[model samples]
Structure formats: structure tokens, C-alpha cells
Target: IKYLFINHYCTLDNLFDILLYTPQLCRVNVKYLCQLHDIILNEIPIILSNLAHITIEELDLPFDVFEIFIKKMTSKLQVLSIGIISMNFTYLDVNQWEQLISQHIPYLSKFHFEHYEKMPSLSNDHHNLLKQFTTFFWIKQQWFFEIHIDTQLNGVLKKLSIPFIHIGHVLNSSILSSQGIQLVISSVDERDHDILLNDYIKSIIISTNITCLTINSSMISCVLIELLEILHNLDSLTISYSSRLLKLHGCSQQSKHHNLSTTMNITKVNMCYVTKIEQVDFILKFCPHIQYSVQMILNYHH
Candidate 1:
């Protein structure tokens, strides 16, 4: 097969077993790549010379295991996109990645890396993490990295990419179990702002049970309008306060016409950095069912 896609959970061994048969695979997309137990490998010559594109939605293995897999399975990888949900500090090793890419995927043109870790536990400062990603090799590859810290739920999100934007929920067990999963969606370039919401919603795994959402983008007002229309089950909403408070009314013209207050069953709204009372009032207009609010007015100077 020239193309292979696995949506179900597969161990590293099982993945290699499958690849053993498909030696001509040019593209592979795995939704969940994991290793539950000790993986014993049989020394077999596995060469996927045509494997140029690889995308792993969830990487649940150690970086060392991944390094071995990449070296053995791929040869001409042009695009590599992977997301990690682990506390392993080794995954953040910049030198390791530089060496791996240099030795294995020498002709790599694009790389998308996403790392999610529980905050307070992850003592590494975002600035230091950013500095680690801004090495000479990364600069040469033109892969800029951006770090986003979500303080409300104590989670840190860091993304490094060539020119791709990734949207996913922060990997938090406590928050996720309580149905308060938070998704941070942002575009790498401002030009893709128009289709950001639409593209993000489509990319995410369908789950209507998500009750909490935290938006970290500057276009929160308009994005909130889109969320209200789509995520009907969302109850708790959090957004950073921006200077474009008046844009709420202008952006919600559709909400004004349609009885949005009746359908928007959001019970809690958190404008954590509210600069004025008018912003709260405007939000309340859309979510009349909001029983709780955590708006803290601050002297937000531009």
C-alpha cells in the first residue's frame, strides 16, 4: 500500500509488524501510537524508502522508543507531525531532535511538534523552553516555536512548527474527567485567522460532552460567537480580555437576531482580565443562563 492510516491504538511492535508488510507506504497517519508494555523487537530489515509523510495524533511512548522507530522505519521523511502528552523531559531535548533529524530525515522540509504537560509540576519556564527551541539548527530550518501557558487550569502548552497550526485540548486528567476540558486554538500566521475556528473545530475529535473551554487567541469575541453556535453543551467558558470589547456586539449580530440567550446554556463565564463592566454585560446578553462569573476588573493599560 502507498498510504496507510491507523485510527485505533497500536503498540510500537504492532505498528512495526504492519509496516513490515507495507514496504511501499509513502504516507502514514496514526491517531494513537502507544507502548503499554516492554516491546521486544525481532531484528528485521525494515526499510520504507518511500515513507515521506508521517502524522501521529497522540504519541504515548518514550522519546528513545520513537527515535529507534524513526531510524528503522523511515528513510525519506519530508513531513513529520507528532503530539505528545507526557511528563518526559527527554522529549524536550533540542539537541536530540537536531541530531535525529540531521541523521535520519536529512531532507525533512516540515516539522510540527506539540507538547502538553501539567503545570506547576513542569518547573521548566516557558522562556527557557522557547530558548531551547531557538537553536541555530532550528533557525536554519525556520521552525519557530511558541509557548502558551494556561494559568486557569494549571497546564502548559508548547508548540513548535514550520508553518502548521495545531488545535488540541490540554492533557489534564483532573480537568478532563470533570468534563472541563480546555482547548487552546491558535494560528501560526494571521492570514489563516478567517478559517481558524472552522478548521480547528473540524480537526478536533468529536466530543459534545466537553463543558469547559478556554480560548487563548486575541479574536476571542468572534470565536466565542462561533463556539456558542456549535458547542451547545459548553457550560463554562473562559477568554482573555482584549481591548475590542465593543466588537462583541458587532460580532454577535447573528446572536442578537436569533434567541442566543435561550440556546446558549453556558452557566459560567470567566473574563479573568476584564477591564470594564460593559464587557461582562455584553457577555451576559448572550449567556443569560450564566449563574456564575469570575470577572476581575483590572487596570489593563495598552
Candidate 2:
């Protein structure tokens, strides 16, 4: 297989065994890479010379264990994206990361790294952690960083459990040094979508630099209007559309107050969790210039 995607939990041994068969795999995306139980390392390395892209959504394995897996690749991987829910800050060690890339994946051209943890649990050493990423190594690679902390604002922000959001790619380097920004909002309960999104947008240093965005939060008309007003440069958007989208059926009080005269320059729109056709119609009204579109309807009761 040239491409493989694993969404469920997978142990290291299970992954190794699977890789053993897919020697010609060029790309692999694992949603969650976890260590269910301890397993002995394979004496023989499984070479994936053709594999050039690797994206691990959640790295549940420790740094050392993951290092072993990287070494086994023995290939010049061109793209590597990793998201980690770190228990130990060892993953923040810039020296180890530099050395690993230098020795193992020397030809790696693109590297996307994300670290997730409860911000409140962090000690004063959080500054030190942030400083490590600002080193010459990261700066030279144009990997600038931003830390999102969940805060209480008029009792709105406090409702969020995991408020991290990965605001996707930066289209213009001149606008922001960072090539991409990912805001991960890890939450268990339903978030106050409008207020939370507004608060998150306010935290951004340069919101205009963010050309593409994915809103996993529950969709609402006020939130959509707020996004249109604030994100003036947004070119593409991905959002959920359900019964809440029906809220925009008529000119609501919020829509009446806001000026909808400014036409959005957005060219692409992707909708998920769509429950009705009217939801699509509502979006089209706001984004008149959408050149490309995609919608996913999970359950069609309409």
C-alpha cells in the first residue's frame, strides 16, 4: 500500500508488524500511537525507504520509545508531524530533537510538532519550556511558537475543559514567521462555542495571518457572524453544521445588529455533521465566492 491511515489505538509491536508487510508505503497517518503494554524491541529494523510522510496525531508513547521507532525507519523522511500529550517534559528537549533529526532523518524538510497538556498544571518552568523552542535551531527553520492558555473571561471561557485549538496554516510568511499554527481544543464537555471561539481569536497575535481555519466547536449563527467580522483575511473554512445551523434561518437579533455588507473573500468551504440542506444554503449566503465546497451528512433525517 502506498498510503495507510490508522484511527484507532495501536501498540508499537502491532504497528511494527503491520509495517513489516507494507514495505512500499509512502505515507502513513496514525490518529493515536500508544503503548498499551511493554514489548521487547525487534532485533531487526524494518526499512521503509519509500516512506516519506509520517503524521502521528497523538503520540502516547514516551520519547525514548518513539525514538526507537524513528530509528527503525532508516529512510530520508521528508515530512513528519507529531502531536503529543506529554506527561514528562522530556519531549521539550530541543537538543534531543535536533540530534535525532540530524542523525536519523537528515533529509526531513518539513516538521510539525504539537505538545498538549493542562496549562494550569504547569510550573514557572513553563517559560523555560517556551524558551527552548525559540532557540536558533527552531528560528532558522521558521518554526515559531504560540502558547494558548485557557482563561476566565466574563464566565464564558471557564466553561471550556480542554481549550487548546490548532489554528491551521499561515498562507503568507510576510504576515507571520510561522508557516502553520495548530490550535488543539481538547474538551470532554460541550463548549460555549461563540464565546470560546471569540476568546481564542482574541488571543492570537495576528489573526489576519490565519488564512485557513477549522472550527470543531458546535456551530452557531452568532459565532459564524463573529468569525466573518474578525477574520478579514480568512480564505478557507471547515466547520460543523447541524440543527444549530438552522438558527440562521431568519435575520436574528445578532445578525440584524451586525453589518453583513462586507463580502467575504473565502473561496473554499467544507461542512461536516450536516443534518439539513438549509444548513448549506445558510453558509452559501455568507460565503458567496466559494469556488470549492465539500459537505458530509452523517445521518440524513432531512
Worst 10 residues of 1 by lDDT: 168-177
lDDT of each candidate versus the true structure: 0.62, 0.62
lDDT string, candidate 1, 22-43, tens digits? 9999999999999888878777
| lDDT (Cα) of model 1 | 0.62
What's the TM-score of each model vs. the native?
A: 0.53, 0.55
User: What clash pairs does model 1 have?
Assistant: none
Per-residue CA lDDT of model 2 for 62-116, tens digit only, reads 8898898999776769889988776667787778888998899888778877776
| Residue 193 lDDT (model 1) | 41
Question: Candidate 2: minimum summed lDDT over ten consecutive residues — where?
Answer: 166-175
Error of 2 at 220 (Å): 21
Q: List residue ranges in candidate 1 displaced over 4 A.
A: 125-127, 150-302
RMSD of each: 16.6, 8.9
